[model samples]
Target: MATLICEASGDWEKAKCVIKDCGSLKSVSDGSVSLDSSATTFGSTATVSCSVGYVPKAEKITCKESGVWEEAQCIIKDCGSLPSISDGSVRLDSTATTFGSTATVSCNIGYDPSVATIRCQASGAWDIAACTIKDCGTLPSISDGSMRLDSTTTTFGSTATVSCNIGYDPSVATIRCQASGAWDLAACTIKDCGTLPSISDGSVRLDSTTTTFGSTATVSCNVGYDPSVATIRCQASGAWDLAACTIKDCGTLPSISDGSVRLDSTTTTFGSTATVSCNVGYDPSVATIRCQASGAWDLAACTIKDCGTLPSISDGSMRLDSTTTTFGSTATVSYNVGYDPSVATIRCQASGAWDLAACTIKDCGTLPSISDGSVRLDSTTTTFGSTATVSCNVGYDPSVATIRCQASGAWDLAACTIKDCGTLPSISDGSVRLDSTTTTFGSTATVSCNVGYDPSVATIRCQASGAWDLAACTIKDCGTLPSISDGSMRLDSTTTTFGSTATVSCNVGYDPSVATIRCQASGAWDLAACTIKDCGTLPSISDGSVRLDSTTTTFGSTATVSCNVGYDPSVATIRCQASGAWD
Candidate 1:
C-alpha cells in the first residue's frame, strides 16, 4: 500500500491536525444561524433561526468532511390582516400577503386615502397607513353679493349660502361642494325697474327694454315742443329721474323794408307761420317763416328788386346794358369765332329772374370728295372740331389721312390723290402693264410672265406715299426628277421647266414600263419614278439546261438554251423584252 499525503484547505491551513469548518454562514435577511458545537469541523451540525415574522428554509444542517455546510436559507413569513382605513376598505392585489405583496385601499364616496397602496415588507409586516375623508378648497365668491359658509369644514358635502347686496338679486340662494372637490355655480345680478316714465307731447327712449340700475332714458319732445331734460338715469332705488316737456313760444314777426308780412295763423305760439311779400321786381329771402323749437322764429327778410348777374354762356360773351340787374334790364350777347347764339339779347324778367340766351357750336357742311377716293365722317353731326376719314381706291392713297371741321364753319382741305409711282419696275422674263392712263395715286398695274416664267406678285399698287409697291418676276423651273432604278434618264429640255419631258432607259438586264415622263406646273414630274420591267423567271425545260447572261430577267436580260446529252430546245436562246415578256 502506498502512503498518502494530505493537505489542509480553507480555515485549516498551518494547523497541527486537519480542522475543517463550514465557514461562517452567510446571514439571511430577517434570519440568523447558530452551530450545535462551537468548533466547526467535519460532521458538525447547525440550526437556522429566523427573526420574528420570518421562517427558516431548513431547521438543521450538517457540515461535511469537505468543510461545506448543507444548503440552508430563510424566507419571509406571512403578514396577517391588511391595513385599516378610517373611511375606506382594503383591496389586496392577491390573496397572498408574503414578501413583496401589495394591497390598495378604496375610500367611500366622500372619502380619500392617505396613500394609494400598502406593500408587505421584507420584515413580514405591511407598511403602516390609513384612509381619511377628502377636503375641498375655499368657497366661491359671489358678484355684487355676499356668501356665508354653512359648515365649518370645507370638505365634500359642505354648503354655503348666498346673500345679494341692495339693488341686486341672487341667482341662487344656496350652493354645495361636489364630490370632485369643487363648489357649485353661484352668482347675483342687479335689480330691474319696470317700464320707463311716460310724458305728455313727448316720448322716452330707454337704453334697454329692462330698466335696470345704470340704464339710461332719453326724453324727446314732439315738433314745436322742447324737453326740459334730454336724458335721465334709473336710480338704485329702481326709479327714473324726473323730466318734463313743454310747448315752445315765439314773439311777434319782424318788419322788413320793401316787404309786407302776413301771419297765417291767429296765435304766435310754436308752429305759427308768416308769409312775406315784396314790391314789384323785389324778392323775399324766404317765402315763409315758422316758429322753431328753440322758442324763436326763423329769419324773414326782403331786399332790393333786382336779379343777379347772368350766367356766362359757353363760347360766348355778354354785356349788361346797365350796372344794375333790376327789372327791365337788358344785356347784349356776342358769340366766339366758332360759336352761334340763339338770341342777341337777354332780359331780366318780372319774377326777379334772368332770361338767359344759349350759344351753340357752328356747323360745317359735308366733306369734299377726292378724284379716285371716298371720305367718311366719324361724327354724327358736322359741328366744329368734327373729323372725316379719307379712303383711297385700291391704287391710290390719301394726301392727308384725316380732316376736321374748322371753327369758322368750314371744312379742312384734305384729298385722296393719285400716286405717281414713277415707271413700273422691269423683270427678266416678264412685262408689266399699267391699268390706268396716269401713274398717280390710286393707280393699279398688272404683271405678266412668258411661258416657263413666273412673277413674284401678279399685281402692283401705288402705296400711300408717292412710291409704288412692286415685286420682281422670277423664272419658274421644276425641281429634280425622281431617280430610275437600274436605268438612266435624259432631259428633253436643257432646264426642268413646265412642259419639260424626261426619257428613261434601262441597263442591259432592265427596261422601263413608261419610257417618258413630263414635268408638271407644280415643279414635279408627273410620274413618281421609273422602274425596270421584269419578264418573270425562265420556264423549265425537260432534258435541257438554260444559262442566264445576268442574275435579273428584266427588260433586255437573255438566257441561252442547251441540249442535255440527246435533247434540244425549240429555241436556242431567249431574251427579256420591255413589255414584261420573254422572247
Candidate 2:
C-alpha cells in the first residue's frame, strides 16, 4: 500500500483517502488519523472522516491506507436532560445521572413514606399518574356510640348527632349519618329549662320530653313538671336528649261552661279569674269567683253562700270578698243576709232551673235575663271579658248600662257627668278625640265630632282598653233619646244601635212607666214596655186612680205619649200623658 496524500489540516489532518485507487489503504500522508466509526480499523494512524449529519465518536478517528478504507466511526447521541423527581417541589429526589439515567420518588415524614415511589419514565418525566392514594380506615366515633358515618366520604349528611359537653344537656340535633360512607358533622345544641316544670300555676308541663346524641331516645316528665314553660324532646340515636325544652306557651285547662262565663285573660298568665252566669233556664251555683291555683273555679262563690248552713263571708274559698250581693229572696226573711251586691250568682235552682228563667241582669242589679240582651262573661272568676247587655228602651246601644257588670257581678254606672252622653269614646277621625278622664271597668265615655264638626258624619262609640285586643263597650246604657217602636212615636234613638233596650216604670210599684222605647231594630224588643197600666203625670195623680190598661203596653206599641219614668198616676191607663194632660 502506498502512503496517502493529505489535503486539509488542523483539528485533524485534512485527509481525503481513496481506497479504490489503492487497495487496502493503510496509512495517510498527514498527521496520525483516528477511526471515525467503530466498524473500521487500520494498521497504523490514518486519516478518517465521519458521515454527514454525524460527528466522530472519538473526536479523532484513524484510517490506514492499505488498499482498504479505514472506517470512520459515527454514533447518534441523545439530548441531555435533568433527572426528574416525583414531586416537582422536591426536584432533587434522585442521584444525578446521564441523559437517560432513571430516577425514583420518595416522601417526607407523616406520609406513608413509601406510598407510591414515582418513576422517571423514558419521557424525562416522573409521572405519578400511575400512583394510588391510600385512605385512612373508618374512624371510630368520639361522642357517645350514637354517631355513624353515612358514607366513607369527606362530607356531611342530613342528620347528625349533637352531644352536649360533659355538663350539658341538648335537644335532638338536626343531622344524621346514613348508610353512605360519609361523615355527618352536626352542630351541638344544648338546652336546659331555667326553671322546673309544672302544670297548675301554668308553670309546669305534663309530658315534656328531651333528647340526646342522634339515636332512639326520648325524654319525659312526671305527672307535671314544675316548669310548664319548659320544653322537652327525644333523640333518634338512643342517646339522652340534650336540650331542655324552653318555655313557649303556658298550658291551659279546658274552659269551664257556666252561665255566660267570661275568662279574664288570654295571656300566658295562669290563675286568672273567670266569672260564670247562666242563660234563661240555666243557673250557676256560685258567681263572683276567682280561679283556683289549680285553674278551677267556683260559681257565685263570692257573696252569698248556698251551703245549706248559715252564710259566712270568710270561707277558704278564693271568691269570698268584701262585696255586696243578693241571693234568693223570700221577701219575708229579714236577718238572713243584706243586699250583697257582690253576690254574683242569680240563677235558678237545679229543680227550678227550667221553671222560671233567670231574671234579666241589670248591669247594676241582676244578671241579664232571656228577655234582655245577651251577656258573655269570661271565666267564673275572671272579669276581663265580662260583658252585659243593657238594651235601651229601644234604638239604644244594647251594650250600654246605667252601670256595667263586672267580674265582681257589681253594677257600675257610667263615670261621665249626666250630659246625655254615652261612654267615653276614643275617636280616630284622624282628628276628633275625646278629652275626658275616665278609668274603671264600666266608666262611660263622652265624645264630640272632630273639632271641625261634620254634622252628617258624626259617629261615636266607646271601647274597653287593655283588652286582649280592642273591644267596644259592653251593655251601652239607654241613649238620651228614646227610640219609638215601628208604630210608636219617638223622642230620639239618639245614637248608633248596639242592640240595647230600656225598661221604664211609673212611680207606682204596680204601674207601668210610659216613655219612648227603642231596640236595635234587630232582635231588640222593647221588653221595657210592661204588661199593664202606667202612672199619670207628676203633680196630679190621685191615689188609687184607675185608668184603662193603655198606660201599660207591650213592645212595638203605637201610642203618642210624653211622660217621665216613675211618676204618680194622675190618670192610670196604658196611654202616656203629654206634659200634664192626660187624655
Candidate 3:
C-alpha cells in the first residue's frame, strides 16, 4: 500500500517512505524531492505557500524519486495605491479591489479643510488625506450700463453707488450689492438727472431749495456747456430755480439755432448772408432787413467786391434812369480798402417820385484797382468774374489788398474787405468750393472724401488765399476676417496630426479680419501663419485675438504662438483662452 512519503518537504531534499501499493505520493500544500547521505531513493512530497499580500504558488507540488530536482513557480506583485490630484488631494485604497469593497470619505462640517479623499485597503481600513483648493472672484465696479461708474474698482465682491463724480449724469442713479459679494443692480433707472452740477464735489443737493434774487448755490456743468442764465435767490427761496429769456443774448445778430449763439457780436459784413425768419407771430415777409453786427442796413444796395452778377436791386433804392442813373454809366464809385457796411439811403427829391436801386451810381466814387485784394463797389451796379491782382512795391510777400467804400457822397470809405489770403485750400479724398474768390478766415470750407474714404477723419479750414493741411485719416475698408474654430487636442503626439479632437480658434477683435492660412501635414508641427491682424483704428483690429489647443481663462493670453528656437516646455506653450465669464 502507498504510504506517506513526506508529510511536508520544504528544506531537506531526502525523505522517508512507508512504501505500499502500485503508486507514488505527491504534495499540494508544499512539495519537493529529497536526497539522503546513504544515496538511497525515497518517495517525497513538497508543498508551498507565498508571502502575505501576494498570491501563493499554484496547486501542484513536485517530488523526484530518482534524485532529480523539480522546477518552482511563483509570481511577484506591484499593485500600486491611490494617486495624487491637482488639488493636492491623495487616494490610496487600490488593493483588495479584487471582489471589490466600497470606499468613502468626508469633510467635517466646520473643518472645511479643502479636500477629504480616501480609499479602502485590503484589510478594509480606510486611508484619508487632506488637500487645498482656491476660490477666485471680482470687485464692486460699474459696467457699461445705466451707470456711468468709475472704472476704478476695489477687490472682487465689494460694493459701490451711482453718482457721476462731476460733469456727467449718472447713467443709472442707484445701485445695490449682489450675492457674489460684487456690486450689481437690483434695478437701474433714470431720474431727474441733469448734467453734473457746476459745483465742487461733496456739495449738498439743492433740489428742495427756492430761487431768490442774489441767492445762489455753487453748481457744476457738463463739458461744452456754461450757465446761460444766472441763478439768483431773490425773495425767500420759493420755487425751484427757474431761467428766463434775456435781451443781452439777442441783438442785430443772426439767430443761432433760435436761442444758442456764439457771443461774438457785430460780425456781419456786406454779402454776409443770414436768413430772416421770425417767431410764430412776426411776419418774416414784412420784416425789416438790417446788418446783424452794426444794425446798419442798406437803405441802398450793400457793396460787394464784384457781385458775381449784378445785385438784384429791390424797391425804393437806386435806379439806372437818365434824370435817373445808368448803373455803370458816367462816374462809377469803387473802393479798394476799409469800406463801411452796406446801407440803403432814401434820396428825398423835391418831387417824391421815388426811384429805387440798391444804391446811386452818382453817390459812388472811382474804384481803386487791387491785385490779390478786394475792390469794394459803392453801388449795387456790378459785373461777375472780376479779377484784382496785387504786388508789393518792394520785396514783401504781403501780396494782399483791401477795398471798401461808403455809399452816397460819404467820403470814399474803404470797407472791411481783407485781402490777406494766407494759404490755398488743399484737395484731399474730396474737393472744395470756396464761397468767395477771396478765401477768408472762419469761412465754411466743405471738403468731401472719395467714395470709400472715411469722412470723420478731419475738418477742412481755409486760412487766407490757399494752404492745404494734411489730415490723418482713420482706416477705411481694406480687408477683414471672421472668427475661426479649428478646435482641440488631448496630447501633442508623435503624430501631432491635429486629430479628430484637435481644435483651433481665431476671432478678430478689430475691424479687419484675417485672410488665409495653411499648414504642412507632418506630425507635431507649428502653424503656417493663418493670417495677420491689421493694426490701427483705421485698420479696425479685433480686440480679442485668437486661441487654441486647450482652455485658458487668463487675460491677454494668445493661443497663436511661436516657440523660441531653443525653448521647450513640458506642457504645450500654446494656451487656450478663458472666457472671463461668471454668473
Candidate 4:
C-alpha cells in the first residue's frame, strides 16, 4: 500500500486523490512529451516540444502524485530571418526572433523609408512584405534662373542650388526635396537700375528709383534757365536718355508811339523793367513795360491831354467866347434874377480840369431880426449855402431853429415863427406870472399858493410844443399831532387839512387845563393845548369805608363805598364828575 500524499498536506489520507494518466497531454508541433504506459503512476515524465519556427528548451520533468503539476519549456514561435528590402535595410530587435517582436527598416541618405517598423506575427512571419523607397516629385521651374542638383534623381533629402542669369538675382539660393514627396525650388527676380540720373541747373523727378524697364524721368529748369529736353526715359539697357538746360533771355523791347523808354541795362535779359513817360503837355496811356522770359515786352502807349467842357454856374448864366470849351478857353458869367457871381469869368486849364477859384457864390447880408428871438450865424460873413440858428428870449420859443442863406443873396425866413405860450396857464387856488413879457418857448412862470393852499409844483415853463406847463396848487395838510401826557386828542376830520381843529381831553383822575389845537395853512399845526389839571383830596365816607381805584380822584373819576354791616347807606359809590365835587 504505497500511497502518495499532497505536497500541500503532509498526510496521505488528508490529500485529494488524482488518477494517473486521466487527462490528455498538451499538444506541440515538431516535438513531443513522454508518458509511462496508459496510466500514470506516482512518478511520470513530461517532455517540452517545439516546431520549426520556434526554439525548444528545458527537456523532461516528472509529474507528482499530488495535484501539483510541473511546467514544460517551449519559447515563442520564431519568424526566422528578416525579409530583404529594395532600397532599405532591416534591423532585428533581438537575437531570438519571436511573436510580438519588432524590426525597423531604413533607407539610404537621399531615400525615404516606406515602412519604418515591421512586427513579427503568431503565424511565424513578419507583418510587412518589404521596405520600399520614396521618391520626391520633379523640381519646380524658377524664373530668370536655373538650378543645379546634387543628384540627377528627385529623391527625398536631395538639395538643389539655384543661380540667377546675368543682371538678375535669386530670391533664395538653395532648395531641397522634402520627405513628403515634394521638391521645392527657389524663386528668381530681375535686377533693377539703382538710381535715376542727376541733372545740373535743373531737377530730375523720376516715377520710381528702381528704374526698371519703362520707367520715366521728368526734368525742370531753375529760375532764369530753360530745359533743352523737358522729359527723359530710362531705356531697357539700364541707361537714362540725354537732357540739357540753358540760361533764359528776353529779346528787344517793343516800341511806343509817343513815349520813350529808359532801360536799366543795354541787354534785355529776364526780369528787366523799362519806364515810359509822355512829353510836357501829354499823358501816357500805360506807365511802364517789363521784359518777360518769353522773349517779348509788355505793351504800352502815350496820348495827348485836352480839357473837355466848361462847368456850369448855379443860379446864374454863362457865355463861352469860343465855340468849343477846350484847353486854354474862358467863359463869362452874368447874374440871373436876384443872383450874382463873385468872379466875372472862369478859365479851362490844360490839365483836363476847369479853374474853379473864379466859381464864387453870391453873398447874403445879416439875417433879419426875429420878433422875440435872436439869430446865431454859422459864419460872421453870410454867403451862399450858409446857415444860422434862431433862439428866443426867456419865456419865448422860435418855430424854426435853423435858417439857410439862399443863392439870391438873402436868408430864407419863411419857416421862422416866434412861439408864445399866451399868458402862463392859470392854476386853481394859486397865481402864476411869467418872468418876462415875451411868453415864448424856453420861458419860466413862477407860481404862488393862496392862504389855505400849497404849490405842488413851484415853477412852470413854456415848452417848444407851444403849450404852458402850469404849477399845481394843492390844499395844505398838517402831519402827525403833537404828543400830550395823561391826555388824548381827537381830530374833527380823518385828515388834518388846513383850518381843521383837534379837541384835547385828559384821562380819568385829571382835568384838561388847555383843550384844543388847529392845523394851519403853512403845513404846520398849532401848539398842543392839553395841560393837565390836578384835583384836591377825596371826600370821606360816614358809617362805612371808602376805596378809590386811583390814588387821586379828579373830574370824571369815581370811588366805591360800603356802610357798616346792616347799616343803611345813602349811596354805594361816590363819583368825581366834571362839577369838581364828589356826587
Q: Would you list the C-alpha lDDT of every candidate in the order shown? A: 0.80, 0.37, 0.35, 0.71
Order the candidates by lDDT, highest first — what do you get?
1, 4, 2, 3
Alpha carbon lDDT at 467, candidate 4: 86
Q: Give each model a TM-score.
A: 0.42, 0.19, 0.21, 0.33
The 10-residue segment of model 1 with minimum total lDDT is: 7-16
Instruction: Please give, for residues 1-583, the per-residue lDDT of candidate 2 as tens digits.
Output: 4454554563444556543232243433222244333344443333454443234444443344543544445442332344333322223344543223333444332123342444444443443422222333354354432444345543323344444564344444434433243434443343333333223323323243432332222234332223322444333333332333222333442444434656666643334555565653344665445544444554451222232222433311123222322233211111112122333433323333211212222233444452323444333422322444344322223434433455444644422221233434343432233434634333333433332232223333332332211323233333444333322333344543444444454432233335545554332445443333333442233333332434433222223323455555442333333322334
* lDDT of model 4, residue 253: 68
Candidate 1 per-residue lDDT, tens place, 430-499, comes to 8888998877766778988876667788888777677877677665577787787777788987878788
| Regions of model 1 farther than 4 Å from truth | 1-161, 164-240, 243-248, 251-301, 308-324, 327-338, 342-345, 349-358, 363-402, 406-583
Q: How would you order the candidates by TM-score, starting with the best?
A: 1, 4, 3, 2
Model 3 CA deviation exceeding 4 Å by range: 1-49, 58-583
lDDT of 4 by residue, 97-184 (tens): 6877888888765565666788888788997745444567667888878888877877777788998876566777878887666777
Assess candidate 3 and give its lDDT: 0.35
Candidate No. with top lDDT? 1
